[model samples]
Target: MNKAKNVTISVYSILLFSIALYTLATLIYSLIPNIPVNKLFAMIVAFTILYLYIQRITLERIIILLFCLFFSIYTTIISEYSSDNINDLLWIVTTVLIIGIASDQKFRSGLEQAIKRNKKWMKMIIIVIELILLMAVITPSSYGNDVGWGKDASYFVGFATHSHTLASACCLLIVLIMTVYKDKKISLMEYAYYILPIYSILFSGARTFLISVLILIMINVYMKKNSKLMRNMTLLVILSSFIFALFNSSMISKFEFTSNNVYAKNMLDSITNGRSEFWKYDLDLFFNSNFFIQLFGRGFEYIYNYNYLKVGIKIWAHNDIINNLISIGLIGTLGYVYIWFKYINNFFKRPRIDFSKVQFIIFMLFTLYIVAPMLLNGLYQYQHYIFSSVLLGQLISQRD
Candidate 1:
């Protein structure tokens, strides 16, 4: 019985790891266009099978799942179905369910142990992802020419939907690698590995990610021992300067301020870009709506409809918090905020001495990743939510 149970656990571990890698890889592989449909179907099937085989149906899990289901159904009923809204709704439901499963104490422990036990494999996976991004940078054929919302250039999209997505993925991967090897002494080669994703972020021209990485590096320098921290910081500065020189034109263009007003220009030069106008419009719409719409949102379709008709631009709210308030309403937004607060609070309550330098770095980066986007970019991307779910699972499992 013991042997059989061990074998089952091992199989589930492999399945879970494969799903995570596949989800990440699809960011690049999705450039093929037709492959995403099949890939997504396969991922859903695998996840369902894994959940059924490994997870025990408990009251808590059931309640959480039901809550997700209810929200999904509510969203569907309140709004007319469009492909984008349907996709967003599906992603939310899937993410909530995964988080629910991951919150299971036993499953979280098992998953964390499995990851630790297979560090070598995890390292290989990270390296592979880095290589994919590198390849995307070197070969123009790997990325599409359509500039979704970012500037048009030979920017590296890697396997992501856009340059920003690629930058976000690289940033997240850097934090994950740091978390995985937080205690171990990293060698020169490993440092080079870290540079790969940093360069990818630079080449992708993601200012938000660049700012976030710089903040993270500064935090590391402050938190670590004097000599070693200075050495690492100096190395990072040198590497960053080299990359910036290589992509001077792109960097300059991104930083160029078009506004004449000093404060507006400064704000635009920062991560806000043109998002302030969008946010203002969204806020106006939300406020002017009826009581029901204000309380429970006007749905995803409402945003596009309002924008196209009034603002002359067919775009969703670029801010996540605003978007959530506009789409899911006050109830859903409050619930989401409550869960986020609980997770962050729980994480800090853990003993400070128990965390390594890298772990602390991960915590800071994750916090920035979650918070930064709420002000500028919407977190409608399923892959990002899925990644967050896994990270939260690992963090929660650390509780004794």
Candidate 2:
């Protein structure tokens, strides 16, 4: 019996190492400009999971994981018929493992210990940042006239693929430093940290990214208001946003490079850049399937592979809600709501932990996710995935 238990622990320990590797690799990816980022990251995480199975699986965690697996399976089934084959249902499985690990007391202790050791590591991180900045400063290519990626109005920026993500990270980091860094009062540097991401998101110019972040900024400030400056900043953002809307057509005209081709703005006329019309047509392809599919789904095979060869539009629904409805029906929507509410309930019930600014900032990032741009479109996925994961981590870990 003891040997069996030892074997179980060993399995889980390996799995834990995988998770740790994933987290570390993710941090590096967040910092670096470009690499074989996402696919490699996923592979590393999967290997980590294999290592983690050394520990005996808790029955509670198993139940949680099963719930996710079934949920994903059901999504595949729906998409099989509806043809809205989205892989988001995989989030359930991922969430179960992430939350289960986060729930562990030892994990929480390790996090606290890391924070304590930050003085030693933080110096290295600072040096690295300074070195990176210096490289950018010295590189002759940095200031050169840019290649236009085959279009006239194309402008390149420093951010890698996930601008919204970087923006959200900056936002959260600023808030954390502002609120949680013990004994540090607000200063010019801190103020810049707070505001830079919000500015960066606006400049990112992805409609989904911009709207989602703005909405969250509004809500977060409303909840954690402490000064007239924040209140004024919020008001100015609203005014500027309204002006931006009125000048939307001009903004389109100004970006002549994107204006000429596949990326041109249609004034948000059709939600998926006319893909919704295709989806409306594709929904007919299901051919009157009954009962289970109408309720849960047909399966994953249909969503990713099916094609509307005749029409120019062949891609899937860019809207999350519509996609969920097609794949999981009303039940999936309810499940999502339950998940959100579950976190909210947990947030309210947990004893106070003084995370200060970071808490509010991270919380706001979550708000931006649902209420803002994510609601509008699905183009900015990598941002959502990471931000959402961190939010989940904070909730389950009950971190301060």
In terms of TM-score, the best-performing candidate is 1
TM-score of 2: 0.58
Please write out the lDDT profile of model 1 over residues 1-400, one tens digit for every residue: 9986676568556644665465466556665776674256436634664464345766766766666667778788888879767766765555555544544456666666666777787787787777776776677664554653334545566766777766656655765665455444434554576777777666665666666556544433333334676657665875577566646635444555323323243465344665676677788877888888777786666777776675566777776678778887877677666555565555555554477665566566556656675566665453543454365437433522
Q: What is the lDDT of residue 380 in candidate 1?
A: 43
Task: For candidate 2, give the lDDT of residue 202.
Answer: 42
State the lDDT at 16 in candidate 2: 31
Q: Give the alpha carbon lDDT tens digit for every residue of 1-400 in model 2.
A: 9885555444444433333333333334535646645446455544444244334376755655566668766555444444233434443344334534543554444444444444344334333433442443344432221433233332212233343343443333333332223234333443343343444444334445445445444434444334758566755875576457524422233234333334323643333444444455446544355766556654544444543452544444455444544555556545544554464444434567565565665565554555443345542234334433443344324443
Query: What is candidate 1's local distance difference test score?
Result: 0.60
List where candidate 2 sits over 4 angstroms from the true fold.
1-60, 70-92, 95-152, 155-185, 194-200, 215-289, 304-314, 327-337, 348-368, 383-385, 388-400
Clash number for each model: 3, 29
